[model samples]
Target chain A: MSRTANGRGGHGRTGGTARRGTGAPEAGETAAELGEFGVIDRLTGERFQPEQTLLGPGDDAAVVAAPDGRVVATVDTLVQGVHFRLDWSAPEQVGRKAVAANLADIGAMGAVPTALLLSLACPGDTSTEVLDGLAAGVWDAAADAGIGVVGGDTVSADTLVVSITALGDLEGRAAVTRSGARPGDVVAVCGQLGWSAAGMAVLRRGFRSPVAMVAAHRTPRPPWRAGPVAARAGATSMIDTSDGLLADLGHVAAASRVHVDLSSRLVPVADKLRDVASALGGDALGWALTGGEDHALVATFPSEDVVPADWVVCGEVRAGTGVTVDADRWGGSGDPGYLHWR
Target chain B: MSRTANGRGGHGRTGGTARRGTGAPEAGETAAELGEFGVIDRLTGERFQPEQTLLGPGDDAAVVAAPDGRVVATVDTLVQGVHFRLDWSAPEQVGRKAVAANLADIGAMGAVPTALLLSLACPGDTSTEVLDGLAAGVWDAAADAGIGVVGGDTVSADTLVVSITALGDLEGRAAVTRSGARPGDVVAVCGQLGWSAAGMAVLRRGFRSPVAMVAAHRTPRPPWRAGPVAARAGATSMIDTSDGLLADLGHVAAASRVHVDLSSRLVPVADKLRDVASALGGDALGWALTGGEDHALVATFPSEDVVPADWVVCGEVRAGTGVTVDADRWGGSGDPGYLHWR
Candidate 1:
């Protein structure tokens, strides 16, 4: 979800500015022109908060009642050039992406996201319209996830950086950790895989058509409620597919002390990206295997039969180490899973 | 707290490689060279994590038990050049300052600091040693406040940006909000005021020493415990002095619908900075009145007598609006209170 701002173009990305139901920012009014208070006022308008918020913005610190007496927290930071290119994205997409990623992390924890904290740092020269667009996208994403934007901070930087922290309610359920996977666990994934990466490639190669892929790349819709559903159905190990399916599954494998073996042809995600892959002369299977930022939930279950419709089995856990596709080890570094520094 | 990172020396401050604690990053061993996982691993070593954490790093989301059934949250961001000049301060000092400011906000809300989430973005070319220093400072600061570093995120940005989100436990006490202030309340503050501002001026002028002031500018040590004390003593409203004493108090006044009349002569913060101000030929009173980032907690108590020794009355709340210094309206804008986007 990090780096997904800029609702550029009229693509029907789930996080598009058009879907935000708001007026566009005036082209001439930059963030510096409006000043900090003005920008904060417009961005944090009344729409983003929910009734469950004990105390919303405009205070030293916000109070959120944690009825379960336990809180689950995760934070993600998206830098302008590194995470997303402003030219490739619209402000709304960036906001949606940030919120969605954090929510995805919470979902991976087997919890329901309840609140979000946004820490935005953009150059003074940024347009207020863009900021508003970003805020609108953030609000839309929060509503979609059944949560609220609670508290945050805004600062001036030479570049734009949005860091989102999401807090969730476990609803008295035991948190599903990465360490819980066992030898007999069945591997599964719910939500997208290679679409985002494929879309990025489409955008990079200057081909605009395959609109669905482009939109998914612009705004990923993480399966927000799947975390709670899987938790109730007995998920053992779980993680959001922010670092590609194989890479994140590798994390689960290492932490759970079990090996995961995936059947390349068995994953349904490759089918969804086949058209986009064809246009780019790319391997959708490879993209589905290692492409990151889909924010998809990758988990291991004691049994696959109980997994809901949102999730599908892709592999199984065995008493070995590392991840393999059809009993062959996954490729080495630079194999598309999306390296941040690179 | 937003703009108080660097202990700025007259030296060129583009993130010096000199100020790290120990272990020089190998030549050309940049963050990019180490790769995301390598850098994350080196930055999140075991020693920095505190034991109060139920689930530490490495999970999708970390779990923290809130025994009081409520959680208070706040976030703040500090940018390079704007917040701190790397040449003037050590990496550790930047980390400490970030954590300290957020803790101050929680304290102002009458809560005990519990966990911190660090969202860091620095250029990939940044040295590993610098990251370690920043992490060390964060750990040290968390330990000083009796809290733990629970989770965080790291990304590559053109500039260094550290955004911190802090969560707190209220311990069954009602949160002290700005709207609760009442007429006839005693207005008081705990901790230093002008020191940080004065220190900044000294650094900006390329004049070092009065070592105390320089240190204060580089790293502010907030009166963290005094916040809970004020709340326990029936304080009606409270805010951390991040926006300078007058500007922050102005926020309290506007929110509480009360006029705050301050006795300029009573604020003793001027005494400590008199020497630094004298050396710079600046006004110590002005700095005390409007200098920011000392992270002092200002609260409105039901009675002057109940206010703790750590705090002293500098004003009184009356049935009116706005703030007055010595029975006169405070100075207009262009004051020292860190205005953003101006």
Candidate 2:
């Protein structure tokens, strides 16, 4: 391993060649040249300590409050090639995606997010400004979710890897888990579906779309408040639309031992995607049903009660063990959903 | 990437011929064959929970208490090659080292650890038994530190990477920061020094020593209580010996704008290391002075009081900048303590 001092006072520049398609300026220096301490100082700028943060960067540990007494926690990791491609996504987008993924996990559990801790690993040639952009994205996402970036660790690696841990507060409410979906419960969704998948397709096919879909694919804006709202509305079960609608619903089915059926007509697929899919001889409905990364809220409610206006009725739970679509079992070749480790 | 699946079930196998000399059993299966859920189930087996844990694993998130209102959080990552070599340590030792590194960060803040969230990335061919051993080591270390492994994420990767986030409770005590050390404070240490570096030297040279030093390097047993004890006893500033004593103390100096002078005779150097250093044509005092990974507690106390029994008065704080030894600038060409992100 090569040893080089890095930090704020080091000889490293801030920005450099922005990978390939990221559109970032290529004038910054790599992390190795900046050194560790200098990079940390740069990352922990004035904005690190927001109003909600009791203590921010610079210390060994950061102090935040779980005023409700209960703290909710979740962790997720995004490997360079497996979870993202540096050539395809900007550093800011990668940072946002990393935070969004963990925040979605927290939202699925019916918690109000409070803080995030990040551990980032990158190659020695990685620019300090790219890292700063990543930090900017993280901060922006946390601010969007009303949380703070409390602390993080940085290291050198062959490939870029980002790991995030999100902490939340339940505020005396019980967590909504996937295991609580009862038979006869109504299934509902609170955000857009298939938009991210459609965006991903467009990106892969080297085509363009109404900027909205592409933006959705690059950085999902999860409805953070819907989590506590569902909990308050007595949601029987809950999950985020991370691994496609059907795949995530399957988790609730397997955990709760209840079958769920979804109507294709209820899902909101982009109109342009329908035309694009028809042109490509593919099914837009499949993308809406099996596409992941939308991060919409999928939940189960009692049949007798009406779901809030924000949530659309997708289907209902039945006495069974698997997920179905419009009374037919989902027999697609892809097994259930994305298994994180697999 | 060779995709051979380990068939040791969820716990992963430990024995296999392909096992590189890491002390792990050679004949073992990979983690992929066991699947993601299976591995999680195997690792968290019937562990008891405290009342503070409202909800544990198996959900999108876990709920724990932040009774004191504020939660202290820190994160650290240990990469396989950079932090530890499999040829020199066992999986259990790696697990312990990972936990210790993060816990030491929490200890530096004078907080009592509450919970840990881990994200692990490993090759698919790794045995389930290896994972089990690693979990066992994590549990053992957490138990020793009076903390809980509340939640974690697992993923497949080309190399083994463990990122841990430790949450701690201040317990109504004010956070002891590095900036708190005063010019007139007495510098003291509460645990072993140079042991881990000596063990590393032994491991690198292919030499053996008392099991204690080797174990010290493998699984450092940090003095967890010393943090809170020193805090309660009116310690003005503190930090763990993750880097060498002088280097780490230099941090306090930089933070507090005070110079620290050390007495070489007062610093603790293991006797066996002294002999080993002599044989290696090196100075044992230098190791004791600059060696890291001891996880020992070093703090500043008011010069008006006698140091506590558990601690030894090794130095004194003076009005100046940077750290010195024997009233002179102590400089050695060896490792300049631990560098973050290295």
Candidate 3:
């Protein structure tokens, strides 16, 4: 899952100082004052490493167990003012979002995460509180995935950029790539769809009371386990909804050389999302169909019976190309999905 | 190995437009004009994937063979103004430098590299020609290492950032970590030492001739095979010289809780380096001791007999703390080692 700017806030958002469980960093000591090693020590020291970590930090490189004889690897980068803002979200939240993006990509391949490597480049004057919060958030999210950060590099840059590489073990299973779907397969999805986009919309409108929506925007909890579950249930293809449901499904469609037609009524849109859409004079269904960054797992199963209980069947794959809703092109209000640098 | 300012030009250095083997991009099309997937296709399409790569690009994640049941991983980032100036070095050279840095770290662990993941973030106005040069350079370097570009993410940012993650296989050997040097071990190094520093000095003085020196500063060729050779020869600890000789050895000293005392006469300072230093009026020995980014492999062996023939013995691990030259602290003209943001 790649970080993309939602249509609402097209960059340039700031927020308050971040506070994390690890406590604020050394009374506002900036990264420059702490120096590189000091910052590294503060971030990596005392963190729990899982069994997969044969070697952790304080070395030239880290060794991780790839028990299945194969490793799944992916990388994603988040740049401040481009993918996130210090004012809109806490440093910890940004950290979680970074990890979530890469982990979700690993999950999309039907692999269980093993280790993560973080390379952070930020202005020297960045407060330790923000750095600590970012590290704390990364550690917390990594813990949730049962993985640990192995090795990383820290450097100085004019901008704050967080790049993460997530490694995963496939558990001896064939990877569920986007090209595996067939014309007869059934399309399904697991986890939240438009909550992040809705949250971003609320945040753009200057209303913080819909805290749940805003939090979802800040830290998306991708359905990490659903990927492997779908793979085990004989999924034909899978991808995460980083670029909205229709847009992500389009990738599967193009790669699988098949057409996807979703039943408009079957595509789940939450009641809470509808309420927010109405209050903001927005389209909840439109957001659910086209907004990105929710990181929901969408996959295609050979038949309805093979679709797992956790996945909601939303569409059918047919012989053709492109994606459609109710047998026609999606007449959504916004673009099907937004790509960076466009 | 991390990128550190060499203390000469500080940061502001610029050069000419990049031209690489793949040919310049179509009429200087900017990345924004091509969009994200288009850029991905251009950078990744038709690239070679070595046998270790089970799945290459155009996927949620790439699957790589980890024949040794474990994977060695490391990450490094190079920022445009911070690590390299596009005007001084071509995009291809910057790409090669980024890969070289991470691969050197993997080699320091006594592992054979298997694959690489690149996360590139640059301004929307960056020309596709530069992007193509970077990709070509990355592919060329990966080819030399017998690996492939497995997966990556491309995004738009205010500055150009190239972050790479390299993975390696240990081939059943124990990883040579930083904390394993013994008190009686002899320190040896393989590959160029002060050439990069001299090259940087030459560039800072606005003289680009002495082509070899400037090239060395642009692209370091780490002795990748020497790492495994040292491991087989019973080397106890290893590190790459990203922060010069004395500074990197200090890491080994602190990690192993041993003192490292170098014999000044035994250290190999190349004749060409002396020639460059003479012309530039710079101290070659000082540059060799304190200048960084050469990425040479330095290791500790039980004794001279077990040291590989290709390595030159320059120092000994002693029963004390801190690094010294001829049993005394180095009186180098500059900092013992430079750290980013210091």
Candidate 4:
């Protein structure tokens, strides 16, 4: 049964009366008083549906059709303090980031996201407004990716944690995996790099910056369409710039069995970050290479084909098994790439 | 990128190795010293995969094929102390419970589980042995369900939280939903009911029970094949008895728009729970009606057909929109099914 805000008489809102006849607590009452299952029923009371969903909440598992014969799925979790500080990001930002992180993964596979299932754990003291904002954020991100929130679960816990599973459709296209790159392919990028990392540095250092990097850290606006576009354009390999650009590129290199060389001169580092880098006494090149969470699209394409408008050629794949800088190993004097996980 | 304990040249017998291939820790290295991404890489390396997995960990998302065309998916989260008590259940049991919960959802969908994606959040102090045990539990459960651990994410958090996403394949059968039950259909149940609840009561009230009930609470053995069998038998609707029997049956009643009448005598309330019920001055019927987490399959079949050997006829569907006990309305005589979102 689909739910709508303006639905039938059963459990519909009574005019100006905060209570419904479902034996639940009044509107302002605490969730503990109403209990977990009761709140779940109210939250899911009336919701719209998309044709892809064969089943939605109230069943053991939801059935969604994968008509294209292949499904691309990814999961990510964002914990309160470790991933996002409540003081720095609103509940909406947290929700958006949680969805964005996983959506980026689906994009890496060159698939169009279809649906999202979110599970949230939060303290009882959390305001309902916060929950509504989080839901709005999830919906906004899903809308950006042309997907719908098919189902979710909410539970009370000591800290707030958001885990999202994103499912995608390949649209009959072969998935562009990281291992497809070969020597002589042109390496290009379609989105900003290191912006989120710079923003995180600013946040950690408690310094205000004139750059939009601060906003980038709060919500990453990944180029969603670039994935399918690259797949259609014969891109050889692809991955999202999640961990620092160099770290993620290293993954592509290892998987593809090819060395990738980046030309620093071709990278477009944010000008606003120059001042922040100076203020923090950090190298912009290091931030560009080692900073993570940018959600940028890094892809390899055949050298003969003209690069797309949104993309900038940054490097080329070479015959090796690791990443290099300007055709040299990263340890050379001028390179600032490669930060070990430790 | 498959890794095995004896195959990889990193780490000693103890699991506390750094990502940089450094020598094993001197007995007590903290996870903080090893770093976040490093621990993730190590844990991913330790995880094993089954054949159904086309691509396992190391990719943004592991790929698994659903040759059957349809996919059944479910997600569930376990919070420390609420869903499980760390003192009562070992980390392995926690892992098993998490997998069991999601796997049971797949079973309720009348599909065969193929793969699982696990997301774990834990405090930094958690030892590598504890994590390994947890992984072993996940692997064990996946093995039991004939599925593989295809992908997962791990992060640091203040409390332990596990979220599992299970994917299943339906072999060309129409998905049996809760809304499909018609009037005059017979209600039948497969597997044990109220066992987990009974065990929980024993643990909560400091009473003892048979090892089977305690094991049931720790790791539920869901009737995995019963769902697909019911589907093949042309059952109209089905659901897993996660929440109390009546509460879950009420879902079928409300969804199907039919009254469901259950004969209390048909419920399999374990004999071990009878003495504990008397000790707590509680009615076993209350536990049978309101107890949750049994993970049993309850479905409606055409009354003219014979029920399966694994299932017992419990009641029948009537032409109304409510649930009853022995022909009396639900919530009568202080016998209400568990409430939702409480």
Chain B, per-candidate TM-score: 0.90, 0.88, 0.92, 0.86
Model 2, range A127-215, lDDT digits (tens) per residue? 86678778778877887777767777777777677888888888788888778889889999888777777777778888656567778
**Model 1 chain A: which ten-residue window has the lowest total lDDT?**
A1-10
Best by DockQ: 1
- Maximum-lDDT candidate: 3
lDDT of each: 0.77, 0.73, 0.81, 0.70
What lDDT score goes with residue B207 in model 3? Answer: 92
**Ten-residue segment with the worst summed lDDT in candidate 2 chain A?**
A1-10
Query: Could you report the Cα RMSD, in angstroms, for every candidate shown?
Result: 7.1, 5.9, 7.9, 6.1
Residue A313 shift from truth in candidate 3, angstroms: 0.4
State every prediction's TM-score relative to the real structure.
0.92, 0.89, 0.93, 0.87
List the candidate 3 regions with Cα displacement exceeding 4 Å.
Answer: A1-28, B1-28
- Specify the CAPRI tier of model 1: acceptable
For each candidate, the DockQ is 0.40, 0.38, 0.39, 0.33
What TM-score does candidate 4 get on C-alpha atoms? 0.87
Report interface Cα RMSD per prediction: 10.5, 6.2, 11.9, 6.8
The digit string of per-residue lDDT tens for model 4 on A1-342 reads: 001111111221112211122223346444454456544544433444466766655566767777766666678888887788878887778778888888777777788777777777777766555565576677667756666565556677888888888777788888787888899999998887877877877887886564488888888887867888888888998888777677678878887888899998886677776777788776777677767777788899997366677988889998987787787666522223222222
**What is each candidate's fraction of native interface contacts (fnat)?**
0.66, 0.48, 0.64, 0.39
Per-residue lDDT of model 3, residues B1-342, tens digit only? 000000001111112123234754553388888777667666666567777888777777888999999999888889888889999999999989999988888888899999998888888898887888898888889989988877787877889999888999999999988778898999999988888888888999999969888999999888987899899898998988888888788888887889999998888888888898889888888888877888889999999999998899999998989899989888866445556676
